[model samples]
Target: MFDTLPQHLELIVLTFLLAGLVKGVVGLGLPTVAVGLLGLVMPPMQAAAILVVPSTVTNVWQLAAGPRFLGLLKRLWGMLVGIVVGTLLVGWLLAGRNWPAATPLLGVALILYALLGLSNKRFRVAPRHERWLSPLIGVITGGVTAVTGVFVIPAVPFLQALGLEKDDLVQALGLSFTVSTLALAITLSQHGSLLQADVLGLSLLALLPALAGMYLGTWLRSRISPLAFRRCFFGGLLLLGADLAIRGL
Candidate 1:
C-alpha cells in the first residue's frame, strides 16, 4: 500500500479476486498468480508485500482445516528449517534492494512452474529418498522464494512427488505455503519491504475479494471440470510467464 491509492487500484483488486478464484478451484496458486500478474506493473517484491496477509490467512486456514496437520509438520520439519536458512541467505535481494535480476528470475520461475504443471509429469520420492531430498528441495524453494517472491518452484513439485493421498497432499501444500509466507514476511519486515503500518490496511482489504472469489470458485468446482480448468490455467500462466520473462530479459 502507498500513501495514496494506487492508480491501478481496480486492477489490483481484480487480480486478487482472480487469484482467489484460482486457489479455490485448484487448492493453490494465489501467490503464483497474484505475484506474476502484478509483476507486469510493479516489482515482484512490491506485489509480494501486498500478498503477505492474504496468503498467510488463507494458507493458515488451509493448513488448519486438514486433519493431517501435525503429521505433515513432523514429516516436513527438516524441509521447513531449510526454507528458513535458504530464505535468510538470499533475503538480501529483497532487503531494500530490488535487483535487476529479480523480475526476470520471477518470470523464469513462473515459466518453469507453469511448464511443469502443464507437462503432467508424476514423480515419486520414497521415504528413504525423502530423508535427504526434503531439506534440499526446501532450501532450493526458499532460495527461489527469496529471489522471486514466488514460493512454489521445487517445493510444489517435491510435495507432489511424495505420493500422498489427495487430502494429505492438499494439507501438505498448506503447511509448506504457510511456512514460506511467514518466512518471507519476517524477512520483509526486517527490511521494511512489506510496507509501513499506515498503508498496510489497504492490502488487508484485498482479503475480502479473495475470500469472496474463493467461495465462488468452491461453488463452481463441482459444476466444472477441474482438469480442463487447470490446463487452461497453466496455459495462461505459460503465456503470461513468457511475457514477463521476455520483458525482464
Candidate 2:
C-alpha cells in the first residue's frame, strides 16, 4: 500500500526540523526530540523506526567531524557493544501492540532527562571505574531506548562523568548515539516494525528538513550562548513529559 504519506505529515516534518536544530545547537537530541514529540501521536516503536535514517546520518556526520575516532572507539567499545546487546535483549517490549506500556516509560525517560539537565551537579566517574560503569550505563541506556526510543538516560550522564575534552565529549556522544540508532534499527526490523515502504520513504525524506534545521541551529549556536534556550528546552520537555506520564498512567 503506497500511501501518499503518513498522517500528520506536516507535524512530522516540523518535528525532524526542530529536532535537528536542537541537535545542531546542543550537539545532541535529534532522536530524543524527534521521538519524544512523535510519541505524542505514534507508538515508541514507530517513532523509533522513523528515526533510523536521520539519526544515523546526522550522528555519523557528527562522528566524522571530530578527531581521534580510533581512540574514542577504543575507550567506549564496551559500552557500545553493551548498547547493542541491551537493545536486542529487551526489544520484545516493543515487538507487539504494547503501546500502553511504552508511553509511560517514554514519559519517565523525558522526566529524567529534564531533571538531569536542570541540575547543576556534575557526576564524575574515576578513570579506573569507567571500565565497569560504562558498560552498565550502556546497557541501561539501551534498555530505556528499546522501550522509549530515547537513549540519553544514564548514557549521556555517564559520558559527561568521564571528563573528556569538550570536542572529545561531543564526538563520543555521536559515536554512542550512532551505535544506539543502528541497534534500534535492527531491533525494529526484527519485529517487523520497519517493514513499511511508505514509512521508510517518509523517514528518508525527513532528512532534508532535518539538515536544513541543523544548518540554522549551527548558525544560531555560533552567535547565542544557549543558556536561556537550554532552560526553555528542558522546561518544555519537563511539562510534556509530565503530561505524557499522566496520560500514560
Candidate 3:
C-alpha cells in the first residue's frame, strides 16, 4: 500500500488529518493512528521514520504552549526512565531479524488496545504502583515506539487510568514522545536509518502537512461527540489491523 508514490502521499495526508483530529479531540494520538495505518503500507522501520518528524513537531508545539514547567517536570521522570529501557531493548530485538514483522505485531496491539478503550472500564494504576508501573509502562511505550512508533496505546491507558486531567495528558504525551523520539533516533542512527541529511530534509518537508492536520482536526473535534469520535477511532483501528494481518499473511 505504501510502495506506490501517488497513493502513498494521499494516504499520508489522509492519515495525518485523522491523526490530528483524534489528538485534538482526545489530546493525543498522531502516532497511534499514523503508525497503525501507515504500517500497512511500509515496513515498520520506515513507518517509524515517516512519523518521527511530525510527532516531534506537534509535541513541541504542545509542550511550548500548553502547560507549566513544574507540572511536566513532576510527571516525566518515571515515564522517561521507562522509555529509555524499552527503547534500548527494542533496538536489541531488531538487531538481525526481519524488521518488517514488527508491523504485524503493531497492528495486533493496536486492535487490542482500541478494544480496551471501548470497554469503558478504566484500569487504574494506584499511587503505590506508580513507582514501578510508570517505568514499566514507559519501557513498554519506548519499546513499542522504537519498533512501530505506537507507544500511546500502553502509556495513555495507564495514564488515563491514573485519572490525569486533559492538560496533564497533553503534557505527559508531549514529554513521552520527546524522550521516545530521542531514544529511537539514537537507535536508528546506530542502525543507519536516521542520517543527518535524511532527518533535516524530511523534517522540513513533513512539518506543514502535520500542522495543517492538527488545526483542521482540532476544529472538527468540537463538532463531533466524544462517543462518536471514540467509535470512529476504534473502528479505524480494527480495519487497519485487519488489513495488516490479511496482507501480511
Candidate 4:
C-alpha cells in the first residue's frame, strides 16, 4: 500500500498523524512529537519546517475555540514580544549549522518536560508578578524553541501557573503555540531553511493526515480517560526523548 510514496514522505505523513492524535487527546504535543520523531530520519530543521503548517492550523483552531482571546492577549503581549524577538535573534545566529549538536538538547528538554508533567507539581504565578515574569518566561521559551524546535517546557508550566480555568488554560496554550509557530517559521525563513519547495509542499500535504488524526483522536478522547492517556503519552515521550539524547550524545 505504501510502495508508491517516497519513503521520507510516508514517514512524514505517519509522524504527523501520530503527532496530531497526541494533540487531539492532550491539547498539546503536536510539535514535540512530530519534531522528536521526525528527527530520527531528517535534520531537526527539516522536521521543524514540516511542522509549520500543521501546528499553525491546529493551534489556530485551538486559539479560536475560547472566549478569552482578548484578555489573554492583553495579559500576554509582553511575553509574545519577547518570544518573537528572542527566537529571531537566536535563530539567526545559529542558522545553517549542523543540527545534530542540538538534538541532545531537544532530547533533554523532552525528558524534563515529561518528568515535570508526571510529577504533577504545580507552580503558581501570582497575578501581581505577571508583568515581569511573563516576559522572562517568554524569552526562555523562545530561545529554547529556536534551538530545539520544541516549545513546551517553561512555556507550558508557566501557563499552567497562571491559574487559568481548564478551558482558558487550553486556549492560552493554543495562543502561545500559534505565536511560537509563526515566529519559528519566520526565523527559519530568515535562515533559508524554510524555502525548499518540497518542504513547503510536504508541510501543506501533511496537514490532511494531521487533521484526520486529530478528528480520530478527538473521538477517542470522549471514550477514554484523559489522565490515563496522558500518563501513557508522557511515558512514551520520556523513552523517545532518552533515545534522542543518547543518539545525540
Clashing pairs for model 2 are: none
lDDT of each: 0.86, 0.86, 0.72, 0.87
Worst 10 residues of 1 by lDDT: 193-202
Candidate 1 vs candidate 4, TM-score winner: 1
Candidates in order, TM-scores: namely: 0.96, 0.95, 0.88, 0.95
Over 1-249, each residue of candidate 4 has an lDDT whose tens digit, in order, gives 112225788888899999999998889999999999987766676688888999999999999999899999998998888888878878888875655578888889999999998888999998899899989888888988888888886889999999999999999999999999999999888766454666777889999999998998898998999999999999989998899899999
Leading candidate by TM-score = 1
Q: Predicted candidate 1: what Cα RMSD to the true structure?
A: 1.5
Question: What would the per-residue lDDT of candidate 1 be over residues 30-57, giving only the tens digit for each residue?
Answer: 9999999989988887787888888998
* Candidate 3 lDDT by residue in tens digits, 86-182: 8878787786244656767777777777787777777777788887778788888887777776776587777677777777767766777777777
Q: Residue 160 in candidate 4 has what lDDT?
A: 95
- Alpha carbon lDDT of residue 177, candidate 2? 95
Model 3 steric clash pairs: 2-41, 82-139
Candidate 3, after superposition: displacement of residue 224 in Å?
2.1
lDDT of 2 at 165: 94
Off by over 4 Å in 4: 1-6
